[model samples]
Target: MVYSEQQIMAWASSFFWPLLRISAMFIAIPVFSGRFVDNKILVGAALMVTFFTLPLLPEHRAIDVLSHEGIMTGLQQLLIGLSVGFVLQLVFSAIIFAGQGIAYSMGLGFASMMDPTTGVSVPVVSQFYLVLATLLFLTLGGHLVLIEMLIDSFNTLPIGDIGMERSDIWSIIAWSSRIFSAGLLMALPAIVSLLMVNIAFGVVTRAAPQLNIFAVGFPITLILGTLLMWVTLTSVLGNFTNLLAESYGVIGDFLRIRR
Candidate 1:
């Protein structure tokens, strides 16, 4: 395989750009997207994977590794990667939101813990829920499927191809909002139950005029909400799993990159 300098340069160019795009996507998406993956290790790992897959990739026009278009290419890659990641982030955050609501209703709001992912204080219960959701995500192969979708993006929407259009960005914004709406629905069961408890407490206090509502209402809300959560957990998990899967599907659809 005697190759000229230009031929070698062209091969090198093709290799680096795809590698860069793949690395950017994985670096921004879930599981792989974490701060836990050190930069040195990530770069090394991505390089290895890129090289591993290089033999099988289809031909594309080689891109200049250092040029004005290359800078734009990297930025576009980063934007697409971030967009993909943010969808997953939004879905996971919805679980956190639901957890917060559940914690407040259960009187677990006072005790806070540092969330390892976000480095912020959250109700201990929310962290607990986040951990459980993380487990569920892994159990259901959410991370595996997500990473696969990312790789498929390179095929459906190749590297050095200018990334998302303006309309695509706006469409993504609309998709992101689904997380909040999904969270509200997931928490709705708990919220509605708590609201009823409050109304009951309000009515009893107003009619009797002798009850200490604050002291009594707190325990009542705490106990009843916890019981409701216990009863409704199966439904909650089912809904969450659906949301997680839907997020992957949505991201794929957005990129016009399917399995």
Candidate 2:
């Protein structure tokens, strides 16, 4: 079929804008953004998703894609996708912070290994929590929900200059406070328990000055911390679910906001 210049531009815009959005999300979102996942695979997935969703998206690309206006529009689309993914990334960061706190309390802070996902060294406790959280994320269909929200976003925000506002940015900043509070709440039980254990060791040391607190207390605390983590797993999972829900809600709010 022969196509005119206008038709060619329209087709290119249709495919191009959605690809930018999808690819940006792939880069910023967890799982897909991990170092293990190949970039070519991500691009292919973005292409496939874009093709299927392109038909559903509104035709608003009347401007020249090679022009300055088109470049700005493309950037705006990328920003919107990245913002959505970044909000969710904060959720996982909160979990990692909680894990670090727990690990430190358990005297395992010095024992760290590289996390394959983020390619950083984190305490074994943090890695444990991350693994469980990732599994829960997938098992609960969180990824599916994310994709659905992304698709719905096109309807809410549309494809144009109308993207995240100043208020929305402030809202994201305000939401960041959850990283501290939520992280603390998740680790609070372990922290309190570990504090009592340390206090007991301190009293023992005071009563029996000849006993080496460093020698005896370290092993006891390490063992107790592991036990405490095992006992607290249920509560930790509950907190993670709550945090994930809140993250999804924040993403929804971001999309629902108007121009």
Cα lDDT computed for each candidate against the true fold: 0.77, 0.87
User: Model 1, 14: alpha-carbon shift in Å?
Assistant: 3.0
- Candidates in order, TM-scores: namely 0.87, 0.96
Judge candidate 1 at residue 202 and give its lDDT: 87
RMSD of 1: 2.5
Residue-level lDDT of model 2, residues 206-232, one tens digit each, is 899999899988899899999999999
In the order shown, the candidates' Cα RMSDs to the true structure are 2.5, 1.8
Best by lDDT: 2
Candidate 2 residue runs with Cα over 4 Å from true position: 257-259
lDDT of 1 by residue, 54-92 (tens): 876767776665788878877877787778778888887
Which 10-residue window of candidate 1 scores lowest in summed lDDT? 28-37
